[model samples]
Target chain A: MNEERELAINPIVQTSVQHNTQVVSNIRNLTASLFGVAAGTLGLESYPGFIFYLIGTFIVSGLVFVFRAEGKPSEYFHRPLGDLWGGDVFSGLSSFVLTWTLFYGLVRA
Target chain B: MFSSPDRRLQIADSQIRRFTDSQIISMRHKNEANIIPSVYSTHEHTTTTPNSPLPLDITLELLASILLLSTGIVLTSQPLKPIQWSRWSGKMSREGRHGTGRWTREGEEVLSEGDPYAFLGLDGGGEGRRGFFDVRGKRREYAEWVKGEPGSK
Candidate 1:
């Protein structure tokens, strides 16, 4: 059998390749959204609310992306919506609390 | 003895992750003093397990919740109230305006008055609106309400 062919046929190699492909797909999604968020947040014409929105999106999306890349709920082959929601809820509550507590202090000071 | 060099190398690389994962699990379980090897290996790892962690049903539920949340936030953030106009035979309004041309309609039903809250799925106390977090509450409530149902916990 051909060397390259034999290697390519390995199930482990296939799994690795699948993993790599998933990573690349996730990276592309993140990069594209990151740019959009940055533009919205820092744009001269955009609302100041955009800045808070961007920060919130970043924290939530970052957590979700990491968990997804880590193969959370891997048995289903597709990442679960509950994972994303849990991530979003947790992040939202965190950002809401942090922004109010910390940002308010900074503004007041 | 006839395995090609590239084939052998490929096999080695393929075994690398699985071997590493197995070793890490073993090391973790054992909690041995010598943990230097797994430290370096687990650092660069992303997702390397012998099997996926979540079961099929729970996984699906989780996925459903995520989709719901993303869509919900986007839809709910927009101001979508419908325009309404009202008039009376003769009435003077503020700002030098007259003829009872008020926006409020006390008895008139607004067309296309779909509740945006409901649309975003925040309008109900039911499971459909609660997502995966509802599973536990719903189960416990039903178990108690079912009246002598077994496994009521």
Candidate 2:
């Protein structure tokens, strides 16, 4: 059982946690802002703007998982679904809303 | 009350400091150690002040543009470019590690192969194709950090 457990564990390849986090955060902040811009440009109202951000974030998360993690969540992320998909999911919302509101104001103005 | 030598020494030190007056009124002092940017800090210079300029002179539209541009870049950027994967993922025995290996990614095929060990971005073991380093060096760098290498950097 002990040997089996060891075998079940992953290999000794390198994974940069800090770099991964940085990449993720950058993605969140930058994209969230963009989402805000799009929503604003589209003149989306408060609730609609927020909803837009949520949907935008899901798209981004999906892309990050499929591309960055290569659909092997366990290999790249410790928490699998949580780490790859859900964690930091909401981070970009602020940026999205900010931009969305700004654009809405800009366009409406 | 009698003063001990240690007490006298402390008094003398303070007296000297006072006499210099120059020391207290010295030129503007800047804390070099405090200048490093903190990851968590919002970087606003003052929290007490209301309606102040942000740390980066950031405006609403500017902030928005930055975010959208970033998302676009991330989307357009090559897939799996940041990650490094070896052919062997299962339990790698000590001996098996040294054996020849190849680069692999999940979504793509037909390109990765024959990356030399000395430069494959392992624990400084990758030769980097004549001591060169790739953008994917983070994984190897991280591995080295995990091993607690003394100044492997």
Candidate 3:
């Protein structure tokens, strides 16, 4: 397969990949929860709340792209779009929701 | 070396942010308890209304904090090594073991387990390998050195 040849030609370092992924995911999860606090503090509801999460994540991704990836995602990630942008978005959602609801109640109560 | 200061700054920033957040929340709670009685005043309602948008200052502060936090996290993360074998090996040989400064929390250098070929040169394998040694050539060189000495003449 073409994929096999491509991999053989330019082999990827598994440890480096895992380390980079772990760092990005850790940042995403921490920032997602922080975004939840901000949204809840601002009293955002329903659609606006979710939209805020999206925007926050986009900003985080942009920061990672610019500073972390050094404007070249392809060098760091195997699939730049999937790994850097979309990867672990869902994984952070649970923590986001947890902090979102907790702060929403605390702020509004 | 450079990351230590940056990480300290990040920690300070987060601590300050947490303090500010708690202060703001506590102040809001205090205001709510004292300002609003059973009468349900319009002024209290205007400020405490769930539908009302947050002040511009608070919104700006939140966005700024997010930006700062993201930058800190990105900068503090470990630098990624090249994935290609050739590049990786070049980097390893260039930086050597201590040049990378990848130390553990206990201040020990992280051993690179990825390079299996590292052992090839560790024991002088290339220069001293069996069957490659020229014993006769060494003996000839030693005799020539002795004959050229002043004591031999």
Question: Which predicted model would earn the best lDDT?
Answer: 3
Quantify all predictions' global Cα lDDT against the true fold. Answer: 0.34, 0.49, 0.66
Error of 3 at A105 (Å): 0.9
Candidate with more favorable, higher DockQ: 1 or 3: 3
**Model 2 agreement with the true structure over A1-109: per-residue lDDT tens digits:** 8855653663323444445665666776766765665555444576887887777767777767765777775655545567556768676665666666665554444
lDDT of 1 by residue, B4-81 (tens): 446534533443333343353343223222222222222212124313332232222222323233322332222211
Chain B TM-score for candidate 1: 0.19
Share of native C-alpha contacts between chains A and B (below 8 angstroms) recovered by candidate 2: 0.09
Candidate DockQ values, in order, are 0.02, 0.06, 0.36
Per-residue lDDT for B1-153 in model 2, tens only? 223446534543443344333432221121111111110122222333324433332233233333333434455443332232433322222223242333346643343323335244564444534545465677888887888777665
Candidate 3 chain B lDDT trough over 10 residues, lowest sum: B34-43
Best by TM-score: 3
lDDT of 3 by residue, B71-149 (tens): 5555666676555666767777766655345788998888654455554445464754344557888999999898889
Docking quality (DockQ) of candidate 2: 0.06
Per-model fnat list: 0.00, 0.09, 0.50
| Candidate number with greatest DockQ | 3
